[model samples]
Target: MKTTITPRVRTLVLLFLAVVGMLFAGAGTASAHAALTGSDPSSGVVVNKAPTQVSLTFSEKVATNNDSLRVLDPKGKRVDVGKPSNISGTTYATQIRSGLPDGTYTVAWQVVSADSHPVGGAFTFSIGSPSKTTVSAAAEQDVGGGLVGGLYGFGRYMSYAGFIVMVGGAAFVLACWQRGAGVRALQRLVVSGWVSLTAATLWLLLLRGSYTTSGKFGDIFDLNLLGQVLQTKTGASLVSRLLLLAAAALFIAVLFGAYDKREDEEKRDLTFGLAIGGGVVAAGLAASWALSEHASTGLQPGIAMPVDVVHLLAVAAWLGGLTALLVSLYRAPADNPVGRATVQRFSRLAFGSVVALVATGIYQSWRQLGSWSAFTDTGYGQLLLVKIGLVALLVGIASISRRWTGRLADSDTDTAKAETVVEETAAAEEHEPEKEHVTASAKTGGSSAASGDPKRAAQLARQQVAVDTTRQKRLRDADPNLFGLRRSVLAEAAVAVVVLAVTTALTTTEPGRTEEDAKAAKASSSSSSSSSSGALTLDMSFDTGGKDGKGIIRVDIDPARVGGNEMHVYVQRPNGRAFDVPEVKVAFTLAAKKIGPLPVTPDRITTGHWAANGIQIPMAGDWKISVTVRTSDIDQTTVDKNAQIG
Candidate 1:
């Protein structure tokens, strides 16, 4: 029982821990907060007129503190929609002042959610015109796919899978890495899991530069922005704290491992200490996920850091343990029967690991998604289904490997028995060397023995050759079964890759709606009463106010439309030359809408003129004009932008 760590084992341990670290650090980068699932106004809604306010609802409850939503008009300008608010008191909302005229507008949002992950998006909607600004409700922007997107996706997959692996792996390895493993392995596992956790902290700090810049491979040293990001919650500051905690756990484990290493096998009292430490670390990491999403808020304390930390550590223990076992199996010096014994022991551990993984996965999903209907109703549910399917595949592969393991182990017994029999027979044949070697006297058995009993000698030589061959050969029958084990392990690895791919995809897709809009329009369709359209022919875009020559204008809009009424706008100069008024385009925005050419575009886009270009200024006062911005079949938004002839 040498205390010195062997270089090979040390290398194996280091590599295994590094993988765990990558898994953890990457877990928060690309995932969570239930995705957009579905929005109240949806991404792009054209209305007959403006609504009272704009709302965005996700599959889960989200934050609405500080910043959340942004509304932009066609000219790429930010329209002060309103202070962000939560629609269901769950997601975000922004009250747009009522009189905005039709055109195209964009709604951009970012938030941290209960899962403690950042999510953001931009969508378009046109007034009067058919605007389907939604890119793909089910399509998630993933990490490694594009800058921040990929990080989020990667982090998500890691968070979920890492929990199962790290937790289960820790338990498995703990029970088997040593005799008194619940305690002994727990301490080491903590240390092992922490190194990467620390590395992730540093890497995340470095990663914020990617956020400040447009893409990956950008300047890693943007000092001022870097410092700012570290200071900000969405950036390095938060991740750093997680890393520091993970580091602390690691240092504690190292001390624990050192102390335990000195204790006798008879006095292995590591379990109590290890369990207490593990419980604390688990609490810390799980809390981290609650604050990880972009949809989170101080108002809803549940969705912030705590849940995230828990999800992360649980996943790490489960997946991290699996990863460790895989490595241990791969590098094990199990050259003979004894080594195979260790393999058998791990196979049993793996069986238990799989069971624990399933239970935990179910628990976590339920806690996050809420209902079975959400599985298909929300975009997040759909992607989750895909990941689940992949997990099923992984299970199938594991089953195959298990079957092969049994066969291979059984073959070893048969092969050993046959070899023993051959050795016994060979020993008996050796007892009669003189008889077996007959031919001639020992003195004459040299060069010219052929002159004596050549035929007899030839028979003896053949027997000896056959006996030697049998002893040397490990029944060719055993080889195929042995190789089968290799195939099974390879298949598991392949399935594991598929799980990663599927999970990555899940990180991007929307969780979808908890309950889809049930409203059906008799002539037109919309889901909600407040969200429904009126019989109003209200042109979606009509301008009311703007200085004769000034580019900047303070325009207001009513967010809700009245029943059966048309909204109008008038844009004119103080001199009153409304003739040939071409090249006029009105761009509108609301939380529920997008930016595009108003459907009422009579004026060509080439000329930058609207449909009402140069008609006439009937009077010097405000004139009513119509602009069309069609969002849905019935939930259309008609906005009014105002301008007056001075």
Candidate 2:
């Protein structure tokens, strides 16, 4: 069978693979993802006695330092049991020191997962040994042990693994797989894609029940679990697309293999076509998982979806393709000319693929890094960096193979042998010109010969031994080529393992969430428990567009009278911090004491919050104010004030 294995075809295939492979490799190196597993004093379980400690379990390891779990008894009482630790490789436990005695107790815990996700959950436990007790909603809300804490932990790990594999696999194809060569490359891709697709299906099925029940059995026919996973806002969109792509890859695979019976060349082309098709499918699945995780975290779906999708597709190709390349080389038929051609083609393509991977990876790193501290302080970012390091190492290895290693030279073995012989001959000839070198070597040898005390003959022998030792040492230090291929392969594989582990970490983390948590805490503290100005219930009332055609202000100060008109009121800023104002100067549009000697007074009601009783409003519209307070310790300041009067 005639095969048109043109250089152009190989180049084209390599170009295509390179772009996609790098992207996939970049996406698989993050790990900071931890979700809640199960908690003790289980949800909806009414206990007669107050348990001493509240315990929770996680699917993976958790950082022991700076992470905590607390259980609050009824009436907002702190009843946390004990210190939380990762006793087992996978489980994290915390003891409840003070015994819990309550109508309902809530266990609110926050901790760092193996991947660095600070996962938290709350559950309620009842106390007081009684004959019969029932778990009620009121009791649940008081301490509200959430239903999802433990189950989410397991789901999180599973999803993390799935994403890393899918992304890593795609990266492998993009960065490592050779196009227009290797009859089996395509078959391997197809096989991998089919397996992942099948796994997704099974996972969704189990997820259907787990979503509803927190966790599910690890078996087939988990229709209920599958249904729930399929029903979720993000899950439905992601899983549906993956399934479609998987089916398509299978069809492409059949077409490729079908031509194998007709001709040998046909089989080679089929292999190339099939591999490309499989990479596409694998990329699709990787993207689905990446985007879905972003969506789950409540980010704007519009931005998160595309950023993550693109990120995953690129990563999957690089990692998956690389793996495929490694596997092919390990098992390829040594004598097959076609296979050898494919290997060479793949090596060429890998360079380009790595470039693309770096570009996309940089973009992703910038987006998810959020802050510089995340690189060193956050678990997720560290894992991602490790992955990147491994990738760089892998690229280094590839470069050596392609450029420095004799394998890629046009006349590899011959060139190496020639170079070695020439070098040896030059060394022998240079013994005289390098007189100082030879003389020094001879002196060292003479000293050693003295220990033997065998006259001039032994001294000469010692000189030769010294020279040989120096040469051998230099060779060992400067040349790795002397080592067998097996050593090189082992070194590369060791590096690969480190990279894979980092990829696992990145999969679990929610890109970046540490910044978000801080912002959220600040917001919760500042925002009003309800509306502050809506349907004013307090004594103070302000009218906008009032009688004077300006702002009118009213002050209904509710405070225990101090000296003149002292009132203590809590002043809160929008960001949830206490604020103070000096002597207030009120006016219609703006506030200044220049126009009139404004009669206003500002005093600290409680240490921070400032208040004014019977403050005057000059105009009718929405009156604005500037309260200025003077003090010895701190300089006096004025703050913007607003009041509406009818």
Candidate 3:
């Protein structure tokens, strides 16, 4: 028989599908927390002599090896010597070959962040003088994108979805409604959860290697790559999850098979055992995430990891349980409807889950945010706000469901009293004497039926139909309240789906506290480097009104004060590679003091560099500095800026 779905159910189904679509739509946009704070022989600078080693500093500790850092020459060839070394927890250095050529070079790095996410980037530095480079920054830093990243992110969401559903559904059956163990619909739901989790876990295991490096789809199935993945922390977590799922399979069997057939006391004993075992398995599954994700590496990891586990379990119990309850309400057989007691029991469990959620959520927010400003300042904090809002909406819908449950309970109690009264009156009437006319009719009918009387059979059928009609009417009277409760629960489940999706994204985002910390570290390092160097550097861009005339000019001055100073200039093409320019001129003027535009003649020292020695600044004041460059004989442009000679 074909069954029609209610309008509410149809809407909820559509909303859930939309949420799932959104999950995959933006899943590959995960962020990393280990930011590059500083690097030696920094980007776009010219050094007269190439340094023996290139060093990098990060805001947080990261895991790196020889392959993590690569130094490539202007021609895109590896130039680094021996293995790269981790100079410190937050610093890494690599030795480069001696007597390197005078040209630009690229340094590309990829490392596992403190939060266990892979991040990579590239930069360029010049030796002696900048030169045209064939290396492209975009091509060198393709560490986290393409098909592999998308698939890995999809696997992550699926794993979370499966674990929540399986754990929550089993908890509902074992704790709130044991009779649900025998329901085929609940059985299928929990089994689907197991299947999803197992499949996603395997998919993740296969993709982890490629997802962390190169982000190539072809490398996903490479056994060597897979073995490399097995040695990492995330790999260990995935393995643990699979082992726990094995135990989960046994738990599901006991719940539906042996427990369903047990007597009352035996059922109770089995339920107690299942609850304990399930709790262990669920916590273990949650730990697999807690020990590998953001919680394990950030501030106060000892407390954060355990709290994260609580948060995951609480979420599963509340959101997952809602799915199981929703299925039971709409799909249970007419003869075995979800009872008022079952609804009340789940209501209590949901309340406790919400309490745990709030407590753990508060601690996590404090840990990740570290301050109030992050709520408005950072992406992680903003997403956290969205989740909190959705959770509140879910709770509101849940309260409405509770009210409907209370109403259903009251209506059922009244129905029970009415049924009892009807039964007692029927019992009293059983003892009453029958009329002589009725007694004669019955005796005649009995005789006709024994002789094969169709008329008597028809009369008996009509009497039985009258009894069935009264019972159906009684059931119809109670359905309005049941339907109301179902609608509210459906709303709760719909909102919970959005909450879960936001949560998945939140876990992948860089926390606000870490972002702020990185920014502070970068600023401090920049300030220290500037003070120690005691040199003024300025960059300007010029378009010389010719084909390919636009380029950047970097001007450097030592002790740029009211005295003689050496000035050097470097020019780079629009592509950021250094190139030679024809006919360059520089002049300075103290316009406020009406000083002459004193010219400092520059002579070519290298292919893309020029030097002017002992240029004098007559006074300590704002001076207009003008630079002119001619790409061709007729094509030239002059750029001007003010400099403070202190």
* Best-performing candidate as measured by lDDT: 3
Over the stretch 328-418, how does candidate 2's per-residue lDDT look in tens digits?
A: 4433332221132344555555555566667667656655555566676666677677787788888777665444334432434434644
- What's model 2's TM-score? 0.47
Tens-place lDDT digits, model 3, residues 1-646: 1123467667876886687677666555457677776677666667779899898877567877567888899888888887778886566999999999899999988888867788887888899888988884553555555677767776777899899999999999987888888888899999999999999999999988888887888888999878877888888999999999999999999889989999878897777788889999999999999998889875678999999999999989988899999889866653455778889999999999999999999999988887788898888999999999999999999989998898775436645744664565445435544423333445466676778986975675555454444443344334577778877887888888788878887877888866765554344334321312657666655656455565666677787878898889887763446768877889889888999698877998997798898998888876777888888889988766555666
Which order, best to worst by TM-score?
3, 1, 2
Question: What is the Å distance of residue 371 in model 1 from its true position?
Answer: 5.8
* Candidate 1 lDDT over residue span 543-583, tens digit each: 22221121111112222232122223333221122212333
Q: How many backbone clashes does candidate 2 have?
A: 82
- Superposed by TM-score, candidate 2 places the C-alpha of residue 206 at a distance from the truth, in angstroms, of 0.3
Q: How do the predictions measure up, each by TM-score?
A: 0.50, 0.47, 0.72
| CA lDDT of every candidate | 0.46, 0.45, 0.79
Residue 540 C-alpha lDDT in model 1 = 20
Stretch of 10 with least lDDT, candidate 1: 517-526
